[model samples]
Target: MAGNTEPLSPRAKLAVTAGKAAAAVSRAAGRGSGSVIGGRVALKLDPDLLGRLAQHLDVILVSATNGKTTTTRLIAEALRAAGPVVSNALGANMPAGITSALAGGSDAKFGVIEVDEKYLAGVARDTTPKAIALLNLSRDQLDRAAETRMMAEHWREGLSGSKAVVIANADDPLVVWAASSSANVVWVAAGQAWKDDAWSCPSCGGVMQRPGDDWFCGQCGFRRPAPSWALNGDYVLDPHGSAWPIHLQLPGRANKANAATSAAVAAVFGVPPQVALERMYQVQAVAGRYDVVTFQNRELRLLLAKNPAGWLETFSLIDPPPTPVILSVNARGADGTDTSWLWDVDYTQLAGHPIFVLGDRKLDLAVRLEVAGLDFRVCETLDEAVQYAPPGRIEVIANYTAFQDLRRRVGN
Candidate 1:
């Protein structure tokens, strides 16, 4: 369902007019991509932009190391049932993106915004949301963001006094520790399949042991909180012990966990489980994730892989062996300047499979693949890469900028 994305009269109309003018200037100036510059300009004009606009409206925030964009999309898909919504549909998590998502429209009853992990506190403090969805935390950009434990600590500080009901992942130790003392938290047993970063306790710096789905810190005695919502296999188990089957167009166990968390968030607004899951089936793609595009005559299933933990999940989505794969990378502002993180990804998953490297960072990616003992050839051009890929749909895994470049080329 398309959102009736007109700006609501919740804020002074002058703020909206000024914000639109900034956006217009940005579009005329041919700034980076689209309206990001415009949004930034608007916020610069009005410091309390989102707070003034989103104070009264129903707002939901989605933040995580991965899946924030996709999960936000899923929640927005269901919240349309409530009323008109304003959301950062372009996967912008910072203030500018949230500003554009909110200031771009008026008369929206609901607002959904995807936030960056580092900026979560500011956004939460600035705007009072109805629900704040905290997904798993892990090591992201080594250059920019804080460590995972530090990220959790910042969250613990930011979320201490919020009135919004917290929907947190019980399986992630970092999330449990971060949301430890929140006044009202609704835990969801959304699966945390990747645990490389969760090896130690965030509180006492002790060993974190995972004993069959539940994690316990041996030293601090912190354990996985009892989840009120769980995804048991193909069924979503309610707090009342009844199970409902939820089918989503998105593939992989990670997406299933995402859907379960999104359903829980939707449930906070009295949205039924059946309705939430059904609407999610319409969102096959989130900002370019899970987007199947015919790029250069080759159908490509695109998934973004920015760091080690995210790479683990993306690798799981690709069909193993004999399925041709395209690996793309770039070191742009959105993507961290440091390409050293490339070594952290478990590229061995593609061992013995036909892999083709593409991107401006193709040479660096090629070196990484070579070190992993994988034999691969380089496809210098997009058409050449598609030709190298096996017939039919090829899995294209890329980082931030490369994926955006590919998406733009595909005319999204």
Candidate 2:
């Protein structure tokens, strides 16, 4: 289905211009990137602005509890092999930010959007995207965001009967339930590391029987679909039984899963799997994530882990023992006011690493670590944490706001 290709009304054009001006003012004031404010202004002036801007572009929306930004970036890069692609590359996924990105990339052939999990359905409805990628669903922002099953229901209802080809993760039960209602779906075995949220079936509310990699609901028989794409150790196997080696600068098996999914989505737009993987190799990091920056004369690799599922994947990316891992967390509004999610993560895995904790909610993390029988030193600042650690490349894992704060301090 083609997007709304009608010309923008005079008011819409004026709204876009005004939004750009507001964004410029915001940048000058050093308040922020200005995408949100600018988009908000334009949206307030023209409620239908996003639709008008997206009319001519083949939009692709990506949503997940984790890896949304990175996957979006990878997809954008891979799609570029076909044509110019515009995206919210800075990790802004809200309506306003999405509007701003669309407005700026008027001439681009494709729109690759990283959408927040809560806003995916609305954004998808407005954009009428050609494709949508549902990565995974787990507990995130427990106090603010809807429950995982509720969110999955919303996705299923919102996407029902849509013409978009959904590229969904077959390993995540919640994702399977969400994309089941779509008209077209291409499943990928992206691998779910944390299955705490999917123990119960969304279809029948029955206990999910997970034996090895296959999951099925005994009551309703809702089981994992055979995937058209699968991720092997170092290769991605396609539906045609062709295995393509994935060589990415990004680390961890999670990223490899993301690459497999990206290749599947890109193929929907006519980009070959080999070409997509080749283009994806150029993306070293998404926003500030996985970017190694020099802080206090020491190299620190930044990894963002906001929830238990994300932490599980992040732990696999960090260097092994004696690397001095700095764990930071915050309870700010952006990080979710409730810090109770810390208890869900298994901190005992870091038992041998020299651990230092710092953030607004460091005490909560420290307590969790202490209960796990791990020793940790709480610090007031990243600088202090670096000072206390023995000299070497430091691995830093932080939540939402804490990661942003450290990224700014490191000037990346």
Candidate 3:
């Protein structure tokens, strides 16, 4: 379903004007980027403001347990080769923030939206997106977010028979199940490193059989679909078996997977795979995920890992042994109230590195580390954590709120 391209209603115009004004006030007040506040105010005046604002543009929505922001950034950058593209580049993945972004980019030709996992269906419905990218789905914010299977079922029901082409990760069983209901899908074999959430089949609720990289449900016979695009080592193979080497400033195999998915989504919008990959290679970081900042006379590479799956990928991005690592964990509202997920992460992987833990939930992390038989020091602040570390480039891995806190402190 394409958005209505007609002129916005009087109410919607008023809402857009009001939202821009509110966002300007928020920026001036130094409260935030004001996307959410502006969007919220606009929606209050006109509930359908998002749909109206998105009417003129072909929108693409990206959602995942991890790498959504990076993939969104990649898609936006790649789509820019086509024309002006508007995106919530600041990691605002909700309705209000999305509305604010669209309100600001009214004249843009395309919209690339980073949608929160829970809100993907709703956002897709509202935006009438041209294409939707479903990256891997894993356990994230367990206390606040829906369980993996439940969320998949929600996506299946909401996106059933949708006109939009879905670019789904064929490697993830949950993502496959979610996009299975869509009439048109471009499957990409994006790697799924974290398999804890996909042990059970979403189809028949039976045990999922994994023979090598292939996944299938023996009882139900639900199997992984052959992908149109496959990530082979350092290259992304196109549908016709053309391999495009992925050279990204971003590290880790996870980012390579994201790039492969981004290329597939970009193809849906008519951007060539080579051109899309070239455009994506320019992106060094996403909303401060891989930013290197100087803090306390030490060079710190900031990495954000929110959940167990995210942490698994982050651990791969860190520097080698003996380079001190700072692990920050917070149980704030944005970080989720439950710190029990910390146990799910393989903290033992940081055995050789000098590990320092800090944040509101540092105690919980420390206990997890202790059980893993890794010695770690608990600090009160990031500065203290840095002070305790040896003199070298430090790798700092933090969860949502804690990462933001450190980012602010480092002025990055």
Best by lDDT: 2
Please give, for residues 286-337, the per-residue lDDT of candidate 3 as tens digits.
8888999998788999999999999998898888899999999999899899
lDDT of each: 0.83, 0.94, 0.92
The lDDT, on a scale of 0 to 1, for candidate 1 is 0.83
Model 2: lowest-lDDT 10 consecutive positions: 1-10
TM-score winner between candidates 1 and 2 = 2
Model 2 error, position 372 (Å): 0.8
- Candidate 3 clashes: the total is 0
Model 1: per-residue Cα lDDT at residue 389: 71
C-alpha displacement of 324 in model 2, angstroms? 0.2
Candidate 1 to truth, TM? 0.94
TM-score of each candidate?
0.94, 0.99, 0.98
Candidate 3 has a TM-score of 0.98
